[model samples]
Target: MTLAVTGGAGFIGSNFILYMREKYPDLRIISIDCLTYASNRFVIDKLSCDANFRFSKTDICDRNEIYRLFEEEKPDILVNFAAESHVDRSIDGSEQFLRTNVLGTGVLLDACLRYGIKRFHQISTDEVYGDLPLEGDDPPFTESSPLNPGNPYSASKAAADLLVLSYSRTHGLPITVSRSVNNYGPLQHGEKFIPTVINSVLRGKNIPVYGNGKNVRGWLYVRDHCAAVDLILKNGREGEIYNVGATDYLQNIELAELICDRMRASRDLITFVSDRPGHDRRYDIDCTRLKTDTGWSPETAFSAGIEKTIEYYK
Candidate 1:
């Protein structure tokens, strides 16, 4: 089977490609990435020697380029991971997020319809459900939850999710959307929280925290996320949305403190700052559907994952 994965050079995409290549050695894989700032080719450089792997530098927003890739590759499975995913950056500039997350998704769905692809997987985020009332003991966001995207980045992702569902309903497209929570592991860029904390502590710099840093997020190890995606792609029901998470919840400040403790850095380096506009107070995902259907659960403990991630940066 030939799989086309967009944004294959980005953090999650690169890790997914590596996982897929190792697990399914005979499967042909074509990765298309625009090599944006967060993209790193070095991650997949070793896979160049594998006959089953191919990489193309292309933008998903360009209709002609996307069409050409579809025609040339004729992928059996299409996974759209291309997006401008940073929340802070999205607050500063939303145009790229809208273009890539919303319009790019539309273009890919159109191409899927034109090409008769078997399965289309849309990688979404828990941020689409926005912040839950931190005051109450409410359950996490589930597939049936209403979307209340707080930031432009999440709004764009929510728009893309709706687009995929529209295509599936109207055009009879075989699509599955997986909404995952905060992912932290190796190869992540320095802008993200975990990496930022680790890098800053190593450099003896203050670890910046937004607000009081009490915002809660469910953390999922990147490899476990890849495993869940693999299961969803193969056995997931069409037009169904699955939430993937490890059920590991931690406050932003708590996470930073854990990193500091692990790295032998003083908590004095922690500095609170003004929160970004539209910052969601907390994000949590209910992975019950995924767990019940696929029997998929995260195997990595938070401490272990953080240690491994920190070591990778070192």
Candidate 2:
């Protein structure tokens, strides 16, 4: 199938591209990206010789440009992985997030309607459901959870998800949404938690932890996330939202400790810093629907994934 993937050069997107190429050798892929600071051009450098791959350097918010490409490629599927994903950056400057995540998503949806694309897949984060209660017996976030985004990044994404659903209903567009947990793997930007901690430890610097480092997060390996997306796009029911995550949950300090242990570094390097505003104490997603429907589950165990991540950084 011919597919148009936005943000294809970014961390998770790059892995997904590589996965698709290996899994479906002849499938044609059109990659649309702005090459933002977080985008890793090197990831797709090796794909240049493949006849099935094409990279277009353009903003997703550019409706005219996106429409031009859509008309040319006549893609069957459009998976939107584009957005300002970092919470800190969003907090510092939220306008760009809104433009890219909210407005840009609107543009893509409009294009799908105009072009009559078969499927539109939105890559979203579990943060849109806000944080789970850290100290209680609260259950994980299901697809039915009310969106309570605590930061600008998640707020914009939440708005985008709404727009996607609206188009699915009003315009008769086939749309699917996948909200996944924290993704940690190769090509991740240094500003994220795992990368930041790794870099600091490797450089013999203090490992900074936010808010006593007790905040918890559910982790998913990038490859596993990529696999889930493929299954969802292939078999997922339209207008359905699926949560993607393994049950692995780790507190900030626990994660730091894991990294330190992997690096053979000292926990003494761990340092607590002021927490960001609206820091979610915990995040967990109930992906039972995805598992039950598609028989998709995370393959990489935390220890194995963490080791691979460290090796990639080293």
Candidate 3:
């Protein structure tokens, strides 16, 4: 089978391409990426020798380009991972978020309808569900939960989710959406929380934490997320939404301390900074539906995942 993976040069997309290539040696992958600032081509250089893998430097928002690619590749599966994902960046400028997340997703859905693709999987974020109370009184967000995105980034993603579902209902396209929590692993951009903390601590610089550093996030190892996506691509029901997470929640302050401790750095280096606007207080996901439907659970423990991630940055 042939697959088309958009945003293949970014962190999660690149890792997913590597995982798919290794697991299905006979399957071909046509990877299209715009090579934005966070994108790194070196991640997929090793695959250059594989005849089954092809790379195209193209933007998903380009209608003609995306349609041309669909006609040329004729992929059986299409997975869209392209988006302006940083919440802070989105707050600063929302145009890119709307263009890529909303318009780009619409373009891909149109192409899928024209190509008659067997499966279209959309990779989404837990932030689309907005913040949970720090009191821990309310239950975690499930697939059935109402969308209440606070930040521009999340609002754009939530819009894309609706677009995908609309295509499924209006055009009868086979599609599935997976909303995952914060992902941390190697190859992630240096601007991200985990990588920034690890890099700063290793370099003997003050680790910056926003506000009181008490904002909570559910952490999901990147590899485990790839595995869950693979399962969904293979066996997931059409027009369904799945919440994927490891059920591990950590406060920002606590996570920073863990990294500092792991790197043998003193907590004195921790610095609290002004908080970003529209920052979600906490994010937690209820993965019961995903678990019951796909029999997939995260295998990497938080401690182990953190160690591995720290080693990668070191």
Candidate 4:
């Protein structure tokens, strides 16, 4: 089977590609990435040495290149991980996010239609459900939750999800979506929350916290997320949206403190910063549907995951 993984040079995408390769030694895996700033060329370079793996530095928004590659490779499955995912960058300018996340997804869908892919999996985030109150019994977002994107980044992703579903309904495409919470592990971009904390501790620099640092977010180990996606690809029902998440969650301040303690650094390293506009107070998600459907559950505890992440950065 030929599998095309977009944004395969990025953090999560690279990890997923490595997971797939290890599990399916004979499978032909193609890493498709546009080599954005967040991309890891070292990972791509290492994977390219594998006989069953191929790399394409191609953008998903480029219809011609995507179509050409689709026609030539005729991939059996295409998993989209491509997007301008940074919320801060999205707030600064939404046009690039729209072009890459929305229009790029459309272009991929068109290619999937023309080239006839067996399955098209979309990698999405729980942020699409917007924010919950910092404290309350508010129910976590389910697969049926209405999309209420709080930022341009999530809005773009939500739009892509809707577009994918529309194609499935209108054109009979086999597609599935997974909305997951924050993922942390090896190869994460330095600008991301966890990595920033680790890097700050290692460099003896202050760890910046947004607002009063009360925002809550669920955390999932990247490998667990990759495993869930693999299961969805193998056994997930078509035209279904699955919520993949773990119970591990922490407020921004708490998370920073935990990392400092774990690293044996001073808590004084943490500094509060002004919050971004429309910052979500919290994000919670329910993965009961995914567990019921595929018997998938998170394996790594937050403590273990954080330790591994810190070691990687060290």
Best by lDDT: 4
Scored by lDDT, model 4 comes in at 0.94
The TM-score obtained by model 1 is: 0.98
Compared to the true structure, candidate 4 yields what TM-score? 0.99
lDDT of 3 by residue, 2-57 (tens): 99999889999998998898789899999899999989986569788888999999
Expressed as tens digits, the lDDT of each residue in 171-268 for candidate 2 is 88999999999999898989999999999989999999998888999999999999999999888999999999864899989999989988999999
Error of 2 at 311 (Å): 0.4
Q: After superposition, how far is residue 69 of candidate 4 from its true place, in Å?
A: 0.6
What is the lDDT, from 0 to 100, of the residue 213 in candidate 4? 94
* Model 1 clash tally, residue pairs: 0
Please provide, for model 4 over 71-150, each residue's C-alpha lDDT reduced to its tens digit, 9 standing for 90 to 100.
Answer: 88999999999989899999999999999999999999999999899999999999999999987899989999899999
TM-score of each: 0.98, 0.98, 0.99, 0.99
Off by over 4 Å in 3: none
Candidate 1's C-alpha runs over 4 A off are: none
Residue by residue across 257-296, what tens digits does model 1's lDDT show? 9999999999999999998777788887788899888889
Worst 10 residues of 4 by lDDT: 41-50
